[model samples]
Target: MERLVQTIVQKRLLPLVLVALVFIAAKIIFALITIVAADEAYYWVWGENLALSYFDHPPLNAWLIGLTSIFFDNNVFAMRLPTFLTFAGTLYVYWLFACRLFPKAPERAFLLTTIGFLASPTLFAWTSIVYNDHLLIFLSLAATYAFADYFSAYSTDERTSTKPLYAGALLLGLAALSKYNAAFLGVSIAALVIAHPRLRTLLLRPHIFVAGLLCVLMLTPVLLWNIQHDFASFELHLVDRYDRPLFTSFKADTFIRYLASTFIYFGPVLMIPLVAIFFRQRDLDQFGNMTIWIARLMIAFTFVTFTALSTRGAVHWYWGAIAYALMLPFLPILLKNMWLYGVHIVLGLTFVVYATVNYSYAPVELLLGGQSSEVARVYGWPEAGELAVQLERKHGPIYLATTGYPTAAQLAHTLDRTDIYDLDPRPSHFSFVERKAIAPGADAVILHDQFGNLEGTAARFERFSKIETFVYTAHGVDINKFEFYLGEGFISDGDQ
Candidate 1:
């Protein structure tokens, strides 16, 4: 018993366990204090319906959350459980893969895995939201690991393992189903096979073909769903967003912002080593050829995707998360030089301080400072939802309109009503007004100050009593103010 205990301690299992505990504790703490962001709430709605696809993302993540919500209820903890568990699972898998990659340096492998977990800002952000990114990232990493192990096993002996190859294919298929970005894995793997003479066996293997078939089979549901829905998912993702011109100055800013955000979110300490490893040509030979290929592919894909989609949208949290994770094992190799390791430690500590100061459990007012109104504009819908409910009871079946869909969706969910409408003339990003315009009967309308032209329509209607106004503040700034107006000749305030 003493020997076993000693062995476990010496193996550093306790520290890893502590790190995991800290990770979960932080997530739970954040979950309690933080309201669901609009994106999270929207995705929760997607989970409720359990469709094959959504307007924004794949269905696997929603399905997972929806299943959990059945047991845990539609609350923060329930919504975040899938994300939290996926992150934790990814950490474990990273360790497993790291151990396989570095059989001689067990401690170093463990450290690198931990650093990877810490350096992944994308993972941290998505883990807090009920989004598909976490699932996709996990599946992508799994495929990478399986592919590495399978190729390594094949290289050692003539016998090929069907399990790893099949599993890798299945994971890659699921990843593709999660997001179109998974296609890059195939590109990366092909590059690896072409680069390494030892890996040429993979090209000749029949199991690779079998794996491809399995991947296609796994993704059949998405294809069928697209067919049934007139390919709305693809159209929305591919065509609808392309209305903007292809060339834009925003491309440079988008690329730079993504790079900075990724570093900030994942702690800089962990990223420095990864970046150092990525740029060092000499260190590339230390790991399997697969790592080099995966890293290069990820970088190329990020650059290409950013350049192409620069006019459409900025790089989002899950966009390149897996690529970051794939580069984890190589960080230690980069840290082999004392100067590189020293710089990494300083940057890592700086990030720790930044995250700590930014997220300390301070009062909401203190956190908002003077920009409270701006913060409110961005995240004020929840407060608006509360106000909307109060107005609904006072005004009776009120017709609500907003410039955005997120506000409308949140208001509808909170009020347990869907009569809310979008006041915007066209279907803008968050156009909930489209629904409200067609609502039956006379309806009261709510408008934000930012809806410049839409507010003019309210003037043409007869204004009755004004509902109470609520001011939303964020970072001590007022981004938007909400005012409620009843239709012309409706009951006055004194009618009650």
Candidate 2:
């Protein structure tokens, strides 16, 4: 028993334990406050419904969040728990990949995994939210790990492992169902197999057949969902891709900015070492050719895709996420370099302090629009609920209005009302109205402060004798005000 314990400790259990501690501590600190953003609330609603897909994302994250909330109840901690789990799971998987690849430098692999986890802003931020991105990230890393294992066997030995290849294919299929971005993993794997001489034998192996079968099996549900829904998922993704020329004058500038931001967001300390590892192929070759191929494929794909998409809105996070797992191999080497290690420590401390300061009472007033006393009061759902209740009492059937689905969902959830409407002027159900027509007699209007041309709407409401406003805050941040107006046409009891 004593020997087993020592064996576990010596085999990098300590690092794994430390990773868990960091994950739990970060989550607990963040969950002490109310939900920090609208996206968090929107995803929570997805969990409540437990659907196969949402208007914006796939169902994996919603399912995870729903499962977590079942145990903890629908509060901040419950909503954010899945994110914490994803972070922990991601670290563990990365460590596993490192161990398999760099057996000689296990400590280096462990350190790199830790640094990569801390440096990724998208990973950090999404981990705190109940969103598809978190779940997608987990599956993506898992798929990469499985692929590494499958291909590694070919280089080391003449025989191939059918299990790992099949597992990887199944995971890849599940990942594709989770999010469309996962298609890249398939492309990366195929490219690696075709390019590497030793791995070409995989084409003749039964594992290929098994992988194909597994992918089809795992993807069956998503395919059915798409078929039933007129392939709305595919259409949504394609429509989102803005049509732009391949090369533009600003391409170089935009790509450079994205590259720089990736370094900053991932933490300069960790990024420096990651770059060093890429240049030192000898250090990386110790792992396996597939590991190196996966890393190179991710980087190459991201740059090419981002370059093409830059002419449209440059969304860096999506590309950055694909490269996350591949970057883990170099983290330890970066830390071993004294200069990079010092920078990383400083950056890590800065992030903790910044996060803490955001929750401090001194900043609460300013952060929550200067009127709210309690951070929870400002950030919580009560204010919105109260406004909804009051409006319902006066108006026969109150209808809520918002520019976005998240805001609409927030009001609907808090007020215990589903008649809530979106007033974005596009085709939608609920009560549809122009910005200038919001008045008490026409029910209530919920408008975000960021909305332009409020003067017209306010003037129309002022014409009515009944006009009231309520303020709401989320996590001590005042999101917007709810304006209720009773127009001239409003009748007393006898008028009916």
Candidate 3:
């Protein structure tokens, strides 16, 4: 087995091709078995609604989901096919960029980097879901690649064509359409142009401004939608989301949380060497290649910005995934010892096993005494959907609702009904999607999760029927408990 592994790693193309195929196959298998989470179901509903833009995000993911639905059913596997494709595309881009940055590195070093990325537990487990991040990461990486290729070519050959620059700009537009975070990509590009003397002269070229215009043109729909809806999306992302004043509350715990998340996202194997390299070099230019310098800037800017945000408030762990992903090219630095390579191979395989088990079995729920929101989101929804159907049948076309957007959206997808109302006052994409509001004194059924809003939901109705508690169990362990109530009469808030 050792000899066979060595032979595969030594081969020019075998390791990359073999690992990629296996990784893709695993994604397929995982997507097939894993149930859809609330956010995914919410996005799936966006596919059903077919909107220009949404309250929470741009329309690109909703558009992709709509396209996926045309070819396949609304099941988890079908909806997530686009994400799988994008993940593969991301890997391909990383391969090209890594090879370009490390021309002196051996084939084995490149292969090791590929294995490290595919086996990162965070990405391996998380990327299977259909999210705007998948599209954002892929397009942003592709755009970065195009810009890097253009710069590298232009530096060597003055007569290099501007096709790559244009392509990069077009992709950056798509990336922006994917998620709001792509603004960071634009910042990186602007910074790269300003810092690099050779590329600075391109400011005189007319094509650069044309490319920028083309990118801005793609955002017309987003701008139009925001105009139609009072720019709520921008307000939500920019102002409403940040409750705390920036840099006012710089907590050590939050900063540590962000740092730890960055480490885990890179995976244990690569994170160690990556930190060592950073500490040893302590300068971006030490990476030597201009292409690498761009990625390093991305890593520095993303981590530093998020680290500050983390000090202010809780930041999502995966927000820095793009930065961590860009560290793939640097993985070749770990190839100094054959023993390190062997250890990396073992660790990579181990991560794959860990992800497969974690996704399928969900041992974390057991460890946490069945209190994982991640587990709860995926399970109990189908049962809740069925209960909603039966309740509506008994109640005779009454309104269905839940305390939160996630539950409401999951119920909508499960029952194939878009009229489900979220009783919570908190705004979500459902706020924009048109549905018949429940009139005063109308009958309605509300579903509440384990998080519990029984009294709050009861206040919205004149009176409540007997509440039924339903617990969903998997493998002899209870996953989540939900309360189903048949309300006597619905009372809409003044705003509704």
Candidate 4:
């Protein structure tokens, strides 16, 4: 036993293994304890109605959820299992990236990168739930690793191979598919390559064309899906992204929230190193120095874009998580300084402790978001579904729906039913849910927020005579009330 233990210590496997195990355990515990979050449940609904892609984003998340739901039963743990494993994959790939980027102290590099990556409060907290960031982190690491190897080969005096460059492009394409935020990586890489004289020749390579074709092919499903849907998804995701109206009406509160949260999301343990690396620019023609430039470019683009966007809309800090991840491989450089290394270890462990304890308790979620707020998106929803089911049985053949997507999705999920639709005042994916609408002479139940505009919802179904209205109270909350209506010569279309 002593001999085996010594071998393990000598190999420096103990710390990396411990970090993986502890983080994996914390994620599993969180998934098991917490109810399904709103966005997660909302995505769960997307899985129920399988499509090539979804209206809100790409289809990788739905694909992952569908695969996970098959083996583990459609519950919180099952839904989140894929994301947890994705996080695990991210750590392993990042370690490889670290080893390649910094060979002198590979073990120390892996350990600190793990601390900087896994111990990040936002990144760690997100592992417990299903988010596209899981896919983003995984694919982004793959891209980073492949890009470094490719860059190394490109920078060498004798060019040995172009395989890594092709592989990097494929990974980057998939990264964009995972989440749109990764598109900025291309921007960063372009800026650095254009500035570096030796690397500028890459822009003229036929290999770049081959890789670009592969990316286009990988992204075909998303494009085709949009083509069939009149490119609504394209309009919503890509066009609307930059379509913020009236920048003159900027909100200080939005900018304040974004600025305050940006530092925390980048992982507090990494603050000093990220700052140090960003300000320092080395010879890009030199091997291994490219990642620092990439890291700086990523950080700069992410903070600036998100901060500008936040002025016109709400931006969550985790939106920049993948950008922060590009900097992790460079963190091992900080390990040479003993005091900073200690700070990284201390902060990493402290975050792990807090996050581990917090995920298991409902009360502590307040620090992240209140149980009812957007961040917590998990509360009283099952209860809402139970009430809907009870009411549905009373009104036989009645169409059941709500004005909002989340409420409609929760009801559909818990009832183990489908076509439980949402009444969107405008076009949305919920409108495409089976192309469903109330038939003529049908009595229907509509759920809406209690404090919300009832007349606004009732106006959508004006053809139906209002029969009864009552609140659906659950878990000591009087929100999500229901109103009964009887249709008069109902048409297939009114307001989508």
Candidate 5:
């Protein structure tokens, strides 16, 4: 630990403390103010049943949120608290990895890497929200560190411990469970093992085999869930998200949109040059480490896969964000020129702009135009829930039903009712819950509007007793108009 204290005191301690404080402060502010986002709301409902896996994502994020719900109110903060803490862990792992990779000015190097992560528009912005990306980032960092240690060993006698190596495999499994993107880590692991002669010795060691077994064990839940659900989640990720099937979904217009979003999200000026630097130094063998090799594989995998998918539709920029930070330690070798600090400022400003758009309206709407309404989804959830409560007093514990999963989730959190669910036509997680809760002649209060598909929801009800539209407003602005349908005599299978 010759370098550990210097890195900790000079680079890690004060900034990390500030990071913690700011993180906590932001958590408090956002948690208290922002309503649940549509995806968050969707995952929030996933916590209600505590399944092995969800319709869209793996179960880790939902499990974390579900655990936190026991300790805090079922609000944004409670659901997102785990994400914030997980980011702190990622920051630490980044520092540790940097310290090992850059021995000369490990402190400064670590600080720069930390800034790289802290200034990421997608990573930083996501820490305040409950996204599976949050969990995957931390786990990805840890697994990256372990792989670097194992492969970058100074000698055969200095090989990495068996425990940490095995732990990396386990973490990767958990990461895959967090989001399917972690599967790309397999590319990194394979490249490391196959590229290096020493690492291939793992073929003889039972340690790697045990780790592989553990990884597959971790996937048991997702596999079982998919089997039960007609492999719906697997098919969704593989076929729907990744499989483009030649020229069908391919479009240059979509590819251009992907480039723009990726550039903006990764930092227009900051990341482009830095990525150049990393690849340049990597080419020259200036900073030869297994960590770089690991990150290189990851970046290549995500870039190639996402770029290919971009031909189909707009790409998700954050797909590479996790691997992006892992490679930042190599930037110092390439970035000795002036204006480096200026680039840092630019990255920070970019983060601020993204935060403003994500949380506020007027400015973002002006810039993003039609897409500005992304912020509107968070509105009216709590208010809609409140209104439902007041109406429940008159309706006498009426069943909660909403046209969209977003409304249903927010309402479920508000009413503390798992009975609250979406009424979409296709069988969803909501379909399973809503069916058991419904009884013949039972009164169901439906919050419906133009936003989501209500498809065949009306036919499930016999007749409507009361129908009215209410404008949901907040902060002196109207968010949306919702038509509340008090439908009595629900027609369940028992009626048939």
Candidate 6:
């Protein structure tokens, strides 16, 4: 026993194994306690109704959730298992990449990278939530590792084999299927290929063309879906999301917010090393140069591209998690200062603790004008679904409706009903949820809020009878308010 323990300690395998186990445990616990956010509920609905693609994101997240539902019965924690598993996969891929990047001290590299992942608020929290980014992050990193392996193997032996390239291409394609942002990986690869003469030769190879074809084949689902839908998804992302003119409004302010959020979400301690790596770049040894270059380029390209986009509209803080993750291999560069390194770990762990305990406590009223608060999204949803069920029981199968996708989705999941209509102009996955509008002149129950357009919602019905108001409260603070109305006649859009 002593010999086994000593061998493990000497190999530094104990810490790595402990960290992985601890991370998995923490994620499982957190997912169990974490309230299902609106986007998560929305995606769960997608899983309930399997499809080729969705309006906001591709079908991978939904597919994972759907598969998990088969086993876990759509429990919140079970629904989140896919994200946790993918994040774990992401960590292992990072370990492989770090080992390749710093072969001299692979164990230490992996240990520090795992710690860095836990320290980042976004990365840590993302593991507990089901989102498309989790899949994207895992597949993108896997693709990155495959390319690094290919570069190292090809450069060392000048082998013309195409297996690694094909693997990388397939992973990249899957990453793209997870989220549109995976395009950054392709750009980073192109930049690396263009900058490295040896890699640039890949462009002329027939195998490279074959790899490209593989990526295109992987993306065929998204393309075919878009074509069938008249590219509504493209318009939603490229045009609808950017409501403001580029460079014409609050450019500096938005850019500053983006940078500040980047620092916070990435963890301030990790940012110090990230910025240091950004400015103090140098060529790694021949075998690792391509890997390092791709990392640097991905970091630069993602942040810089989003920085520019932030000028036009809000760029979410979590969007930069992947960029911060790419900084793992360079973390050893900071180990020269043990005190700072220690502080980095301390700060990161502290943030993780703080976020785990208090991330869902935001108290806000349900409003329709702009972004709703975390409390508004999480709280009162179950009660609203329950209320809808009671109303349906009382009134004999009334259509349940709401004014927004978030409410519609959360309530739908709680009630296990897909017929809830979002009676608003905004486009959502509901458009493809395979449900017809409540028949004209049919009775329906509308969940109304004070701050929402009650007038417009009321206008959709010929008459409404007010029901009791439902309030979700925590610690003497009301988190959300819902006013229920039983409408006598539902009016479809064409009726007016």
Tell me, by lDDT, which candidate is best: 6
**Tens-place lDDT digits, model 5, residues 276-366:** 6445354322124576777777887888888888887656787777677666666566455536645754666555555654564432453
lDDT for model 5, please: 0.69
Estimate the TM-score for candidate 1. Answer: 0.78
Candidate 2 similarity to native, TM-score: 0.78
- Give the TM-score of each candidate: 0.78, 0.78, 0.88, 0.85, 0.85, 0.90
The true-versus-predicted C-alpha distance at residue 306 of model 4, in Å, is 1.2
**Per-residue alpha-carbon lDDT of candidate 2 for residues 64-160, written as tens digits (9 for 90 to 100):** 7678767885566767777777777777887787687668766556655665565455556555566666767788888888888867776788665
Compute the lDDT of residue 378 as modeled in candidate 5: 58
Worst 10 residues of 1 by lDDT: 425-434
The lDDT values for all models are 0.61, 0.60, 0.73, 0.68, 0.69, 0.75
Query: What's model 3's overall lDDT?
Result: 0.73
Two-way TM-score contest, 3 vs 4, winner? 3
Q: In candidate 3, which residue pairs get closer than 3 Å at backbone N, Cα or C atoms, i.e. clash?
A: none
CA-only RMSD, every prediction: 5.8, 6.2, 3.8, 4.1, 4.2, 3.5
Alpha-carbon error at 373 in model 2, in Å?
19
Which runs of model 6 end up more than 4 angstroms from their true locations? 1-4, 11-24, 251-253, 280-283, 359-372, 434-436, 449-456
124-177, model 1: which lDDT tens digit per residue?
556556667777778888888788777777766648667987888889988887
Backbone atom clashes (below 3 Å) for every candidate:
33, 11, 0, 0, 0, 0
lDDT of 1: 0.61
Question: Cα deviation in Å at residue 302, candidate 6?
Answer: 1.5
Candidate 4 lDDT at 379 equals: 44
Q: After superposition, how far is residue 367 of candidate 1 from its true place, in Å?
A: 5.1
Model 3 scores a TM of 0.88
Runs with alpha carbons beyond 4 Å of true place in candidate 2: 1-24, 31-36, 69-72, 104-108, 241-260, 283-287, 314-319, 359-380, 413-419, 425-447, 451-466, 471-496
Question: Higher TM-score: candidate 2 or 6?
Answer: 6
